[model samples]
Target: MTKKRHAEIAGAGFAGLAAAAALGQRGWSVRVHEMNSELRAFGAGIFIWDNGLRVLNAIGAYLDVRNGAFAAPAYETRTDGKCLSFQAINGPGQYRLLTMTRQHLHAAMVKAALAAGAELVTSSEAVGATPEGELLLADGSRLPADIVLGCDGVRSRVRDSLAIPQERNKYKDGIIRVLTDRTGLKGGEWDHVIDFWAHSPRTLRILYTPSGENDLYMAMMAPVADTEASSIPINPAPWIECFPQLAPALTRLGDRGRYDVYETTKLPYWSVGRVAIVGDSAHAMPPTLAQGAGCAITNALGLAVALEETDTVEAALELWEKRERPLTDHTQRRAAEIAASRVLASGMKWDDEGLRAARHIPTGAAMPFVDAA
Candidate 1:
C-alpha cells in the first residue's frame, strides 16, 4: 500500500499547485483551496530560468512547460539605448529560458497537480491558518490536516490568518503588463529575451515573447512616487509617457490603457511549526530579476524534499526553512540591488559613489540584480 500523507494547501497559484504536485507524487493526499471560481483568464508572462526548469523536471512537467513556452537564450540590460550588460544563459544542461502567460502556466500546473492526485477547489479562499494545523476558509469552514502550506499571493489571507505579517523592505511603485498582437522588436538578439531599461530614479523593464497565436506578452515596471499600491489606473498614461521609444510597443498592448501594478513585501520567515508559506506569501520581490516565480519553484522543491526526508510535519517544516531561507535571502538582496541600480539607470543619477559601484561590475552579476526579501 502507498504511504498516505494528508496536506492542505491554501491558494492554488503556481506555488500551491507545484507543492500539491510534489506532495501528491510522494503518496500524499493534497487539497488546494483558491479564491477564484476559475483560474485567472489574463496575466502577463513569466520567464522560467534553468534552475526553475530543473525543479519542474523533478515533477515531470518541464517538458510541458517548455512546449507551451517560447525560448530565449539571454537577457539584456540597457540604459538610454546603450547596452551596459549582455548576460548569456548558456551552460551545460541549461534549458532555454521559457516565457508564457501566467494563466496558461497556472492551468498547466493545476492539470499536473490533479494528475498527481491533488484535489483543487476554486472559489475557496482560506481566511486563516494555525500552527497546530487547521485551515479556516472564507465561508467559515475549517479543515484539519497534518500540514498547512500558504501559496497565496502577496496580500495573502493565509499569511495574515497565521498572524505572520510580512516584513517590509522596499515598496513596489508600479507594474504594468499588456498582451498585444505586435512583434519584431530589434537590437541585441530579440528572439525571446527580456529587456530591462534603467533610468535614474526610474526603472522600466519589458518582457516580450510570442504566445503561440501570433500574440505577444509584455510586462513593464516603472517607479511611482505619488500612487498608492492599488491606485494605478488600468491604463496608466503617465507610466507610458516615461518610455517614449517603447510607446509604439505599448500601443499594441491590450485594450486596457494601463497595466496592473502593486506593492510587495517579504516575510521574515516562511514558516512556523506545521504551517509554512511559499511564493508571494513568503517573499514577493520586484520583477527586476524575473525570479519571483523561480523563487516559488525553489521553495516548493525544498519543501518537497524536506517532507520526503522526515515523517514529522514539524520536522519537515524546520528542514524546509533551514534549506530555503539562505537561498531566498540571497535572492531578495539581489533584487533590491538591481531595482536600486535600475532606478538609477533610468535617469543617470550616478553620484561619485554610484559611479564607483557601477564600474568593474561583472556581466553575469548584472543579469538579475534581484534578491528575495
Candidate 2:
C-alpha cells in the first residue's frame, strides 16, 4: 500500500524538481522552495543522456522534455574542424541525447511538478534544520515535514546544518559558453558530437548542437585559479592558438554575446541525519562526460524511490545515502580523471598511450544502471 507523506525539498534545480514530481505523483504533499525569485537558467546547454530520460519517463514527463528540446543524434571529434575521432550512437537501445537550454529543462521540470500537485514557493531558501525538518528563510521560520531533502547545490545551507561536510577539493576551473543564433551547420556535420581542442595549459571543449529553435549552443572549458570569478571571458584567441580546429565556427560567434564564460565549484559530503543531498550539492563534477545533470536527475529519482519504500524519514535517508553515495563518489573520481586530462601540468591526457592501455586492461567497469520497473 502507498503511504501518504508531506515532503519539503530545498532547491529548484533539476534534481529537486524531479524529486518533487516523483513524490507528488506517489501521493506525497510536496513543496519545493527556491531562493531565486524565479527559476534561473545557467547560460549553457546540457546533454540529457538516456539514463536521465528513462527516469523522466518513469515520472511521466519524457514527452514534455522530448517535444520541448532539440536532439543530438551523433558525435564527432575535431581539432579545428578537422576530424579525429568519430563516434555515432545509432544502435538500438543507444540513447538519443537531448540538447536544450538549461532554463527550458528547469521550466519543464517545474511545470511537471506543479501540474502533478507540488507546491512551489519562490524566493525561499533553507537556512537551518532540526532533527525533524528544515528551517527556511533567514527569519528562522520553520518548515516542518515528514522528510527534508537537500538539493540546494554545492554551497548548500542544508548540508551546512547537518555537519558541514567539506568538499573533496575546490573546482579551481572555469568554462565559457555561447548560444549562437544559427551557424547553418547541422546533419552529419553537426550531429550530436562535441568537438574538443586540446591546447596544453589551455584545453578547449565545446558542445555544439541546435536546440530546435535555430539556436546553436557551444561551451568551452579552461583551467583557472580558484579565486577567478565566472564573469571572466575565456579569451577566444588563446583558445584558437591551442585549438586551430575551431577557428571557422569560433569566428562566426563574432560580436554576438553568446560566448560567455563561468567558473566551476563543488562539495564533498552530500548528506547528514534525516537531511540528505542530491546532485551538485552532494557531488559536483566537471562537464567532461556531460553527466552533471544526468547524475543529478538520477540521484534525485533514487532518493524519491527510497522514500517511497521506507516507513520512516530517517530510514529513507539511510537508504538514499547507501544507494547514492557510492555512485556519486565514483562519478566524482572519474570526473577528476577527466579534469586532470585537460591540464598540461597534470600530465594527463585522454589519448595518452598508458591511459589507453589501462582502459583496455580488462578491468571491470561498474556504472550505475537504473532498474527498469
Candidate 3:
C-alpha cells in the first residue's frame, strides 16, 4: 500500500527535483509544481563537487549527471601567470571536478524524479504554501500534502508566504560567461584542468573550465563603482592582465556584457513546521564559492535522509535542518569571505581541517576585483 505521507515541492529546479527524487526513492509519494509552463535550466555552466555527486548517487542519478558532462581532475589557482596551487578535483581520471550546462543537468534531474514516480506539474502557478503542506495555486485551487519543500529560489513566493524574515543586498557588480570551445589545451599532469587567474594587487580574476572535449566555460565578474559601468565598455586589461595564456580566449569572448548579482541573508531557520525551505530559499551565498547549486543538492539529500530516519514529517524536517545547518553556515561564511576581497581569495590551500569551509570545486575567475562592500 502507498504511504499516506505526501511531499509537495515548489519549484522545479535542481533542488526541488532532487528532493522529489530522493523522497520517492524512500517510499514517499511526491509531487512537484513549477510556475513556468516548461522546466528549463538557467543556460549557464555549473560545477558539481563530490558532495553533490554523492547525493545524486543516493537517488540513483549520478551516472545520469555524468552523461554529457566533462571529467575535470583538478582546479588551478594562478596570479601573475604563476601557479599558486593546483587542487585535484577527484584525482586523475576519477569523477572529480566536472562541468555541465544548466539545461543538461535540469533534464537529468527531471528524468530522475519521474523515474522515481514523482508527479510533476508545470505552469501550476503556486502562489503560496501553508505549514501543513497546503499549496494555494493561481487558479484558487489548494493542494494538500504531508510536507512542503520550498525550492523556489531567491525571490521565493513560498518563503514569503511563510513570512520568513530575510535580508538581501545587491552587489555593485555581476558576471558574464563566455563559452570557449576546443582550446586544444593539453599535457602537463594538469592538462585541461580548471584555470583560475588573479592579478597582483588583484583587480581582475578569470576562470576557465572545459565543458567537454574542445569546449571550455568562461566567467568574468568585476565590481561596478559606476552604475553604468557595464555600458561604459572599458578595457579588459584590469581583469586579464595577469593571465596572458588567456589573451586569445579573451579576444574570442569579445564583450559578452554583464548581469546583476545579489545575495540574501542566511535565514534564521530553514523550516517552519512541516514546510521547510531548501536551496537558495534557505541559504544564498555569493557565487564566489560556486556552492549555490551544490549546497541546494545537499539540502535535498539531507532532507530525504532525515525523512528515512524518522516516522513523522515534522521530526524529519527538524532533524534535517539541525544536521545541515552548521555546514551551510560554514559554506555561507567562507563564500562571503571570498566575496569580501579582491586579493587572490583562494581557500584551496587551507589546512586539511579547514577544508570543510570550502564549497565543492568553488572558483570565481575572470572578473573585476571586488571593492570593499
Candidate 4:
C-alpha cells in the first residue's frame, strides 16, 4: 500500500483551514498549526462571493455557513447623501453572495476541516519553514512532512525564510470595523449592502453590510491621515454629520473597533521545493474587491487538486501556481486600481471586468469525489 502523504500547514485562517479540509478529504494526513491559544477570527464581517461559496460547498461547509449568513438582495452606493447606483445582486444570472460575521465563517471552516480528519494544534507557533519540507516552530523544534504550506498572513515567516522576492505596499486609506445589533434601527434599506462615500470635508466612507438577522457590520473608511475619522472608540460627531442615516449604528460603536490600513503583498512565485505559500502570504490585496478571503479559499482548494494530480511535490506546486496565479494577479491589480481611484462612478456594476475570478469554477469543485462523503 502507498504511504499516506502528509502536509503541515501554518496558520488557521481561511487559507490554512481550507487547505486542511481539501487535503484531508483526499486522504492526506494534515496538521494545521495556529499561534493562538484558541482558533478565532478577527474582523467584524466578511463577504463570500460565488467562487467562495462553491468552495465551501465542495468542502461541506456551505450548509453551516448558509445557516448563519445573510444573502443581500442588492448592493447600493451613495455619494454625498445621494444615490449613485443600485444593482440587484441576487437577480437571475447573478451569482450568489452572502454576508456573515468572520467568526461564523471561521467556525464553519473549522468544523469542516476537523470532520475531514485534519488535526488542529493551537498555541503552536510556526516561525518558519524550509524548502526541504520542514516546519520550524517557536519552541526550537522542527516538524517534517511531505509538504509545508505557509498561509500565515501578510507577514509570513515561512515566505520570508524561503527568501521569496516580494513587494508589500500600504495604502493611505484604512477602515474601522464594528458590529452592532440591528434591533430598533429604523428608516434605511437594511437588506442591501450600502456603500456611502463623502469626498469633501475630509474623505470618509462607510460600507454597510448586514450579517445574519441580528447583526449589522459597518466598516468606516478614511484616509489614515484623517486622525479623527480613523481613530478607535470612534467619535460619532463628524460621521453623524455626514451620514445621519447611520447615526444610531455609529453611536453604538464600541472599544473593540480597530483601524486596519489597506495593504497588498505581491510575490513572483508561491513555492520553493516542497514548501509553498498560500493566501495572504502569497497574494494579499486591497479589500476594494472584497476577494481576499474568496481568493484565499479558492486557491487553497486548487492547491489540493494540483497535488492530487501530480506524483512529485515540486511539480504540483509549479502546476498550482501556474493555474491559479494569473486570475489572482488580475484581481489584485484591479483591486489596486479601484483603491487608487477612491471613487465609485455612478451606475457602476458589481459584475464588471474586475470580478473575473468570481465567475471562475475552481479546480476540484466539479469533481465527483470532492463532496462525496
lDDT of each: 0.67, 0.65, 0.71, 0.88
Q: Judging by TM-score against the true structure, name the best candidate.
A: 4
Ranked by TM-score from best down, the candidates are 4, 3, 1, 2
Cα TM-score per model: 0.81, 0.81, 0.84, 0.96
Task: Tell me the alpha-carbon RMSD of every candidate.
Answer: 7.1, 6.0, 7.5, 2.2
Kindly provide the TM-score of model 1 when superposed on the true structure, using C-alpha atoms.
0.81
Candidate 4 lDDT, tens digit per residue, 267-289?
A: 98899889989999999998888
Candidate 3's C-alpha lDDT? Answer: 0.71
Q: Give one digit per residue, the lDDT tens place, for model 2 in 13-70.
A: 8889988888887789998888989887775666776666766676656777777587
Ranking by lDDT: 4, 3, 1, 2
The pairs that clash in candidate 4 are none
* lDDT of candidate 3 at residue 165, scale 0 to 100: 77
C-alpha root-mean-square deviation, candidate 3: 7.5
Question: Model 2 TM-score?
Answer: 0.81
Using lDDT as the yardstick, the better of models 2 and 4 is: 4
